[model samples]
Every structure is written in C-alpha cells, then in structure tokens.
Target: METVAITPLDTAAGAEQSHDPLRRQQAVVALGRRAVAAPDSEILLHDAAALIADMVGTDRFLVAESDPNGGQLTLQLVTRQRYGGNKPLVHHVALDGAQSLAGYVLQVGHPVAAEHLAADRRFQDRFLSRHGIQSALAVPLCLPHRSFGALAACSSHERIFDAGDLLFAETVAHVVTTAVARCRVEQALATERRLSAGMLQTVGAIVLVLDARGQIVHINEACQRLTGFSLDEIRRRPVWDVLPVAEELDLFKSIFDGLRHGLGPVQFESCLLTKHSERRRVAWTYNTVCDAQGEIESILATGIDITEQQKRQQPEETPDANTPAGNPPSEPEERNRQHPNAADSRKVPVRRPSPINVERRSRPRRSYPYRQSIAPVQDGELPDPAEFYQVQCNDIAAGGFSFLSPRPPESASIVVALGTPPSLTYLHAQIAHVTRMRKEGKWVYLVGCSYTGRAFY
Candidate 1:
C-alpha cells in the first residue's frame, strides 16, 4: 500500500482554516438551514457540492458512495459536477484504490490532499491522469457508526492543496454526514408508522388512539366498521360523543379524565351506540401513553366487541306463571348488580346502574340464537334446502333484519328462515347494505336485508 497523507478532522477546524474561513463557516450554516428546510439528500448534495466548490475555488466536484450494505470493496462514483475544462468522461469505475481518486479516499477513511499526483505515491488513478487532474483534495463523509462515502475536488491544472483546503473539505463533509443521519432516522420512523397503521387495520379488535384531553386522534378499520363512522368523521371529537351511551356518559367521563393523572390502565365493559343507532357491547383495555418525563401524552384503547358473546352467555327470561294469560311480562324491579368477571351474582356492581338506553329502532327487534338458512328465491319460490347456507341471525324487526356471515350473500333477494325447526317463519327479503367487522380473531361481514314481500319461504 502506498503511503497517503491522513488527517483526523478534529471537531474544531476554524483555527486551521485558510486565510478566510468565514465563507466556509457561512456555507456550513447555509447548508444546515437547507437541510432542515428540505430533506432531499440529492438536493442537499447538489447545493452542498456547489458551496464546497465555491469555498475551494474549484468547479470539479464528485461524490462517491458504496452500496447500501457498504461491505463491498468498490465505491461507485454516482454523482459528478463539473464547471470547467473536463466533464467526467467515465460514469464510474472499480474502487481498487488505484482505479479512481474518490475510491482511494473512501478506503483510507480519512481526508487526503495531494498537491501533485504525478510525483505523489498516495494514489495513481487513470481517471485523474486521463482528465489531467494535477491537484486534488478528498474527504470521507463518515457517520459515528459507519462509513457513508467521500467528496472530492479535482483540478486539471497544477495547484497546491494546503492544510487550509483540507479544513474546508472536512467541514462540509461533517454537515453532509449529519444531514444523512437525520434523513435515515426520519425514513425509519416513517416506515415504522406505516407498519403500525397496517397492523392496526389488520387486528381483530377496535383500536382507538386518543389525545390527552380524551379527544379522538385516530381509529382503526375495526372501529370504523363497528361504529359506522370514519376517521374523518370522528377526528378531534370528544371520545364520549360517539362512544358512550347517554346513560353511561357521566361514568365514562370520570374514568377517562382520571386516566391522565397516573390513575391506571383501566378495564371496563362499555356500550357503544353506532351510527345506525344500534347498541354494541365492547370489553375494553385502556392504557396511557407517557413521555420521557413521565407525563401522559396520549392514550391507547383496544376493545373487543363482545355483543354476541355476552348474548350467548345470558339465559333467556321465561314468563312468570303468575302473570295474566293475555298480559305482557312485567319488567324486573332491579338487575343483578355484579361484574361479569365476578364468579357470584352477589358481587359488587362495576358502576352505578343508569336507566337503560332506550331502543332507537322504530320497531322492536328480537335476537335469535340459531343460524338461519338463506337461499336465493327463483320465480318468487324458495330454492331447495340443499342449496342453502346458514348465517347467524343478529336481530330481527318488522321490516328488516341483520345477520353475520363470513361473506356477503350471492343474490340480492333470498328466502330466509327466522324460527326454530317445525315453527320456522320463512320469508323473502332483499339485501339492503353490508358492513365489515372482526369477531373471535376472524373477519366477518354484517349484512342487512329488508323484507321484499314477494313470497314466503
């Protein structure tokens, strides 16, 4: 290996700068401003290259970088800026130290200043010889962890490169390295954000990210489907607006406001009234997001829709024998005041019991436990039972009904069975709308259909 001059490029370069270092100092400041204002590395590189060229009084500047891995022995001279006699005739070449001047700088991992290449044993690049570059100054753009690349200035005529020139080159290289580090961090953060958003959308639960003030910041796809409201429709709105039923609003407000005061990661079962004014029960896990100083920044709330699960667990109430034969069953004076997680019915209530939220639907609806077999109607007649598939019926009303299925039904109009085996009520209905939701770690669609009144199944 030939003996090449090496400079450590200590942090302080002001005292060692050429006759006037003010211009170089100003250049560093200007480059930094541009770096903050515009993060495009190429634009920063170009602007920086121009500034460095002006500082050293040379128009020949080239930036060379290796592959992303930087494990390769060769550096690729990707950019060349020429303002005079010779434009870089060759785009790139091998970085075997002797192949090109830029390549040698990267390998040395130090700044190099060669006043004369012909007599200099440091590097004998055919590129420098071919282009008649007699004077050169090279500096490595290095990060704390790894080597980035090198910046080089070449001259066709004889010129003496002194310590002052070396200082200027290193100063600019430092700025470039800092900018590169910043850009890398920003790119990594952006990638992480995209990955987080994708995961949220894919999860089988509702995810709500809220600000410190209990206002909505973001909501995932599961939330949108369950509430029938989109992010744009809910953003910056108080969490209570679309979430809590009117009766539970006061309790919800107390729990949420206390969250920011280091209270805790709370757990509760809450009722949500959807955009269609339908009620859904969700079991939630709420946690606080804190900053470095231990102050709450935001909150993350994840909930699983337990509507059907709760319904399946609750036993149907049978009418009392004491009631009059023709009279409707009377409402119970009180409900079991106990938490669902509690093993005994005598356990304490989770919260104060509020008046039950009134049903919003115009007509009363009933929940059916059994799956209903639905098949397309042909010529106003029910299809064969062999061609039918069962879908879980959610609730049924006088005019329409909703059901859960893995996918949408094949036809717009289909015959549906509403009751148990022998006394099943079969009717024809038209699909009205569809919504997507997650249940039990799987995706399912909720299809709403209206009675077509064409014929009975």
Candidate 2:
C-alpha cells in the first residue's frame, strides 16, 4: 500500500469538500451568537463579514446594503487580508450597471457563485480583475417582508468558492438579516421618541402628560414656566396638588372621568396656582391617550395663560362727575354703547347696592330735572333725549350716578345724560343694578349706574 502525502492546497480543498455536519452547525451557531451580541446594524455587518472571511477560507469579505428604494447598493462593511494584517473598510457605492455580483444577487434575489469573476461574461466588472479577485459567492439578505442587501465572500486564488461555500454564506446572511431588521425597528422607535420630546419642549402652550390616576408623568418647558414648578418636582405627583384650587380640582376630576368613559376632548378655563402662591388664569384643552386595547393610558393637557390679556381688557373708569355737560362720551363709553356684550359675562359679577347707601349716599344729590337719552336694548341705538320720556336725576358720584325712573331699567342698558349744573357733559353709563321702592305713593325704580369710561366734557 502506498501512502499519499496531502499538500496545503489539497488540505484546503479537502476541508472545503468535507461533509462535517457538526462543523457546519457550529459555524452557524457562532454566526447567530455574533449577530445577537452586536449592538447595532453597522457593528453586526462588520462582525458578520469577518466571520464569513474566516469560516469560508476567503481572503476578502464584503457586505453591501441596498437602498430602501432598491436602486443602489452601498458597501457598508469590507474585511480584507493584507500583508500587515486583516483590516476592515467601509464605504458607499451606487449600483447602476446590472453586471456586478452584488447587483446580480440583489436583482435576482438569489445566490450567485463565480469561479472566475473576470472571465465570467455574464457579469463584467473591472473592479474584480483589478483587485485580483478570481472567485466569489454572494447571497441576498432576504427576509419575508423585504430585502436589505447582499453578503459576498471573495478569494484572490482561483476556483476557491464552491456549492458548500455558497450554502454557508446563505446561512450566515439569513442570521444577519434578522439582526439588521431588529436594529432598524429599534432605531425608528428611538427617532420617534426624540422628535416627540423636542416638540413637547418647544411648543408655545403648556403641555402635561398624566397617567390614568391623574399623576404627572411628563411636563414640558412651557408647563414648567407657567406653573413655576420643575418637571423633577412635580413628576409622579397628583396634578390637583399643583393646582391647589379645590373648585378647579373637582372640575378637573370630572373631566378626567369623562375621558375614561370615552367622551370627546374637554375644554374649559381654570386657574393654576403658581409656586409663589399666585393664581394665574389659564384656558386648557385636554385629550386622552389610549392603548392598543382601547384602555385609557394617559391624558394630554395643553393650556395658555390669559392673565395679562384679561387685565388689558378691564373696563375703564368713568371721568370725574364734574365733567362739563356738552362734551361727547369717552371712547370706552362709546364702545360699550356700541357692543354691550363685549365684556365677558362670566367674569363680571353683579351685586345689588344697599338701599340705605343709595338713599343717604355721601355724593352730592341733584334734584334738578335733566333730559337724557336711554338706548333700547333691542336696537342698541340711542334716540335723542327730547324725543324719549324724561327722567329725574336723583344723585351723582364720581364713579356713577343714581336716577329715578317709572319702570325698572333693563340690565346692560346704556344711559347718556346731558345736564346743566354739572356743566355741559355727556356720560356713558351701564345699568349696574336696579332697586325698586315706593315713593310719594308711586312705584319708582332707583337705577344704580357705573361709569364704564371717562365722561366726555
């Protein structure tokens, strides 16, 4: 019997040809572990390339990822053996011509093995001949949903890749594809979270996110500024605790209850108690956040501060009662006469003046007869005092004056008085309150008025 010696090339060929199931299984398991251990897609691709180069006995390995639109392939990871050592390279390339091995694998959605890349007329690529790559194997990183890219192993030696190499490359590609898909989903979720955070912080209105129990989960920068409480201070605390208004808390709870019952968004005005104990009026709109199963997960509250706006809109005081009689009414008086309902009815509280105070008021009493025009609520227009019925002036004050009329004046009625002793003057007044009393066996109405603006003199 003659004993034959095996050369290094023969040993290499024998290793490639061997049908060792355990060795193949171990290699597949190692690649799967590497995929799992990698933190991101780029790192995963780099590790996968190095693993393929070592296991397939190739001098170079490359991972080319296709663009999402499928028109291009970018070289994401490349591991090549050099004289000094094996160094990894990364770059991007556009796949235009259909003859490249990576392009062919991606287009056909299958694996391709070339024993001689330069000689293969099916695919003409000068890069292969220039880089001394004689043999190569490429498999598409295909998943059920979409194809990501292609993985290829190339050798400088001739006829290095075979059917066994193709199968091994395909297995590794499948493992890497799953890992890449996971990383992509994670990256998308992370990006969405960042965008949401940025919007919450930059939006003009105060924003607060609360759990089902009304505990604050998140508060934006606007909310912090409006409430004067930092997010760290209020987080996990009940939203009502910061509000500090018992009446508003009850209203807020009712609104949240409505949300739990699947009601539409609730909008209302309330006051927010600041850290310094100052009360600031705010208008808020609340919406509910639901989970997949339609359960209430969180509540989103957006609010705007209206304190300064309300202050700027307060009614101006009437001019001094001694204003001359001939002048026109002030601007606010004119405006109130034009649009009586412009003042917010919800904010203005009506109070009845004491009968004793009206009778014995400290202000001077004028019994002299004065003709005045009374604007009818129906048309909001004031007819001339001479055409309408005449009324007696009872008393006067710097802020307002009282008059006697046969009937009770309508609420929000505009009174314009032109008198002589008070000097020529026109007054714009609103009927603030009315008192009825019996005087000289006749039912007379005492009309208490407040000057809404400066009396024109």
| Model 1: ten consecutive residues of lowest lDDT | 317-326
Q: How much is the lDDT of residue 79 in candidate 2?
A: 36
Off by over 4 Å in 1: 1-19, 71-90, 93-98, 118-120, 204-457
Tens digits of per-residue lDDT for model 2 on 1-457? 1111212223555455443556777867977886777556765665565556665666676778778787677763343433223334445556644547777777677778888788886667555556677888878887766778887777778865667767877788889899888877775676457437634643799888888888998988888887889999999998888774654565566556656655435555566899888899776767666644676667787787877775665421221132223433356664454335335211111232223324333334344345554443323445455534456766555345656777644334454655544453455565554444557986565665555543333
Clash count in backbone of candidate 1: 0
Tell me the TM-score of model 2.
0.41
* Separate clash counts for every candidate: 0, 9
TM-score of each: 0.39, 0.41
Tens digits of per-residue lDDT, candidate 1, 1-457, equal 1111212222235324423767677768877887777456654654555455456655356666665667543322222333222222435565556666666777777788877877778667766666566777888877657766677776666777778778877888888888877887776676457446544544898898888888999998889999999999999999988788886676467567657545455555668989999999887766676654676667788888878876656322110011111122223221111112112211111111122453434456666445777787544456887877788877665455677877544444677765567666666555554444557876565666555433444
Question: lDDT (0-100) at residue 39 of candidate 1?
Answer: 59
Candidate 2 residue 205 Cα shift, in angstroms, is 5.2
